[model samples]
Target: MDNLQKCPQIVDILPTAEGQVRPMTKLEPQEQHEVWLRAVELAGGKVPTGRIVKDVVQKIMERTKVPNTYQIGEVCQILVKDNPELRGKGGCWGIVSAVNEFSCTLRMWDGEYTIGLQHLKSYNYLPAECEQMQVICDACGGLRLRINRVYSSGLEESVQKFLESLGKLNRASLTALEEKLLKVLESEIRD
Candidate 1:
């Protein structure tokens, strides 16, 4: 009798004192109904024999769009206004020297300028902002001047040495020397 319970239908069967079998008593209705459904599914249409099907759908949809293009000269104009390094510096405009799908190079007055795809939106030219400014030596009392441009790193060390030598001179002589140096710088820039 215990061994018979291992069989699906036998577990659903009942026994009498003579050991005769009959249908089992109606069990929990809901549980029995679920079991019957699952058993039928297992038998393929009466029971689901193949793998269960699940929906594989994406939650997000991304935008796939391209950007617009501008003329070569138009891009150069924009860089002159927006890029700080190029602003107010005359002769820094030109046509787009080269361009690819993603970026373009502008032939600027200073050098070749490379810009990105997104940055192209702001490209346009403005009138030259200001005249070139000159740097006058404070010590020379307006005698020497140079272009207000970046100097090599080593040049700064030389300037510091010159300042130290000025410190060692007599007050009157140092003043004259400073003026002379300023005049020399002014001449160089003027040349």
Candidate 2:
């Protein structure tokens, strides 16, 4: 016991490079308890229950994790915060025309632009809303294959209809005039 006072003590241990330390070594029970107590103190002195902590972690992951895949026809908004090429396109909504592993081809009002998945945010619209957006896009000459060729004055009518329906789509509600216009267009297409 007299030799203990003469022994050298570890004042501070520097962080070693990752994997240089014994990565597979397990902490002793007492050491683990000490670590847990430190963590609790760091976390506002709250003693977290296991089930509640697990649920909170899961919710955090769901809210923070970026989606790995995007589907065609999904309505998404372009995020230009970190992308220089997408300037002036922030808050602009688009439809996904093609989907790649890590990117998507978006069809916007002016033209189509290929953007990365990280720079796109889903609008989370219902299937009917998506279909309505597609129709509106088709009328705007984005998807020409599905567009009806009926031209009132060299595509002027289609352009006007596209603009009119855009407002209704955004609000998800149609005025009386818009309902009449929709009926007229539907009958015109049938005839």
Candidate 3:
């Protein structure tokens, strides 16, 4: 176990699918080692100087700048690797309710959050997929409001708070039974 702990962690290159491929550039072995060392230091929270880190980050940003920024109504997945506020919303999908120069206000299942561009990844979903996701979010919000109205035969803040506490149910994909239950809930809310 001690020997295992001494081994370095290996990073897989391009482990996930990306919308665009970055142009490959050749680097000497020494250059690659230096880059890896700097990355490891950053990951370990050992910043020698904020200004140096900022400059390096800016250069990297210039190289990897997105051609088009997010637009309103576009769907994006929240990347919470470095944002403590978005701790639990690591890969949750949200719709862009508002777009700013470097951030977006996303309308998620639970609520709206304004997140920086660094903490968002475009879903690159098809138009139909995006439309369906919007419908799901709208339906969920509408159903929650209806439930609040029906609870105790009046609109109640306590009921709304309780529903919000459910918080997306943390299900990556719905089970068949869950899908049926959602359909039933929607139908009940409609009536």
TM-score for all predictions?
0.26, 0.41, 0.48
- Give a tens-digit lDDT track for model 1, residues 1-191: 33333445534532222211111112344434443344333444332221211000000000122333644444344333223544343223334657655566754322455664433443344422111110111233222112222121224556635533442221223366565874564454456
lDDT (Cα, tens digit) per residue for candidate 2, span 49-166 = 3433333333433455535577889999888743468865677788999987557999875567898766799999999989998877766563232223332223455554663234
Task: State the TM-score for model 3.
Answer: 0.48
Which residues of candidate 3, in runs, are more than 4 Å off? 1-68, 143-191
Lowest summed lDDT over 10 consecutive residues: which window, candidate 2? 7-16
> Model 3, range 1-191, lDDT digits (tens) per residue?
33224434423222122211111122335433444344435545232243333334434544655444787788898887534788667777789999876578998765689997778898888888788877777767755454334443433466444433444443334568655655555565567
CA RMSD of all predictions: 28.7, 16.5, 11.6
Question: How many Å off is the CA of 149 in candidate 3?
Answer: 13
Clashes of each: 19, 0, 0
Better candidate number, 1 or 2, judged by TM-score: 2
lDDT of each: 0.35, 0.55, 0.57
Q: What is the lDDT of residue 13 in candidate 2?
A: 24
Off by over 4 Å in 2: 1-67, 142-191
- Candidate with maximal TM-score: 3
> What residue pairs are clashing in model 3?
none
Positional deviation of residue 184's Cα in model 3 after best superposition, in angstroms: 18
